[model samples]
Target: MTSKSERLKDEGSRLQVTAAGATAGLISRFVIAPLDVVKIRLQLQTHPLSDPLTHRDLHGGPIYKGTLPTIRHILRSEGLTGLWKGNVPAELLYVCHNAIQFASYRQATVFLHSTLGEGTIPPSAESFIAGAVAGGTATAATYPLDLLRTRFAAQGNDRVYANLREAVLRIGREEGFQGYFRGLGPGLAQIIPFMGVFFAVYETLRPHLTHLELPFSTGGALAGTIASVTAKSATFPLDLVRKRIQVQGPTRNQYVHKNIPEYRGTMSTARAIVQNEGFRGLYRGLTVSLIKAAPASAVTMWTYERALRFYISLGERSVL
Candidate 1:
């Protein structure tokens, strides 16, 4: 049985972790918004032509064959603000998503530690399990915002969304309530393994890097970068499928086409991509995605760790 003071302390710690996670997520999303826009554009590119949607001239040869070309084209056509098209929803999603994730992760870790005992399981395994739970919980809570953000980011100037409310109401009216959860199956699937691998790898490598006498932030950043890259590479295909499903609707917005077969579910989406575009289709935006993930993960984890430490210090002082 825990004392009242101990329970209060634990609650304080959890709230602090949640705040740290939200701050980290907001800053990281803002830093990488441009790359995020580019990655979505690349992922939404299903045809091999200079489609107005993706701004890619697949037939224009080598110069247009990569991420840099895509970036240059977005800059030329839409200017700087274009890169942050969905920033509002993106920022909101991150704040809620990551706050829930880190808070749940800590709580889950506590439960697991108590149930399984500290020495009963390896720390890496414990972290992986806790991360999966946290990721799933967070994704379920904020998935609708995620879908809206993806659609907004992938949209061209063809349609104008006055605000987030308009977009939500439109999607609901057009696609039904299910529209909000469009890619939920694949999103949930991707996040579980994605977070499992991320936390496992981060926990495993962080201690080793810290032993090298690196600054705490530097060590956390490096570990996060490596973990994110690895997890993202492994789950890129699932992510692509989730994005595709999220953007499919009745609207003539970018990425949706009547000619293309509508995906019924996760496996169907995978089959469609593979059958139509080959295995490479699943990896379409992989390069830009990796570029975005590395720095975003670094900044997020570094900030999270630092903020968590600061909060913990404050708690300790208060307790004393």
Candidate 2:
């Protein structure tokens, strides 16, 4: 049987985990909303979709002119709620995404230690490896739901699918299983670095800051913010490509007009961005991404940590 003191420690840990996880979910919603808006626009090449004549311009022009103008354009034409287009799917996806991410990372870390005889925290490279695998796996598992979310977000209350379930069912029925995994290569490309750097940097910084005796939340938030910004910046190009691929369809014919063959796949997307929008194209939604990711990642890490701590505490009490 567990001792009373041991039970209290475990209970405390469990409470911490629960609190952290919930807060992380809330934070991700707020932070990612704007970035999500921009990413969708750039990925879908909104202007091309909107204009019938210049629709084929996507083959050789900037998908999005710039961030502020895009936001203003969306707001003016679509309304403030337009900024939060497809927010329902976005929020729901985040909830499941974060739930899987936090829970898996925790479990993965333990598995790593046991299998590899590493410490609980693993090395920076190890953290990145584990994070990439976990992030990629989670994204793949949830790719269809994510695809639907991207479609809804891109269409923005256009009466596309009735809801998420309908969206998934419709896609599977209409496009087949492969349709659900559309843009997977680009998505995985983005997630590997996004999750890898996110966890690696956060894990590294958190410990160092803690050693300096700072409060846990303060350190976690700081580390999380930095990690999100860095990770988002590094992976911005892949993000742009993923969005484009996810939204490609007969109905979504914008990216098809270019005469170039290279624009078809992952490498071509990158080349096109460079040729068309220059470096700026790669970071079309970068500002919004930073705005969203900082808070979201910060809250996610903090909340997840708290939730895990709490769950452990409860387990200890049960043992006792």
Candidate 1's C-alpha runs over 4 A off are 1-12, 48-64, 211-217, 252-261, 314-320
| Model number with the top TM-score | 1
| Candidate 1: RMSD to truth | 4.4
Name the lDDT value of residue 210 in candidate 2: 45
Candidate 1: Cα lDDT at 41: 77
lDDT of 1: 0.81
Native RMSD of candidate 2 (Å)? 5.8
lDDT of each: 0.81, 0.67
Q: Count the backbone clashes (under 3 Å) in each candidate.
A: 0, 27
Model 1 agreement with the true structure over 1-320: per-residue lDDT tens digits: 78423553555477898999999999999999999988887777666333344433343211224788877867776688878989999999999999999999888887876787754777788889989999999999999989988877866555446679999888888889998999999999999999999999998998887545454458768889999999999999999999888877775343322233467799989988887777888898899899999889989998888887788888889989
Writing each residue's lDDT as its tens digit, candidate 2 over 226-252 gives 888888889888887877677665436
Give the runs in model 2 whose Cα sits over 4 Å from its true position: 1-23, 46-68, 119-122, 156-159, 211-217, 254-263, 310-320
- What clash pairs does model 1 have? none
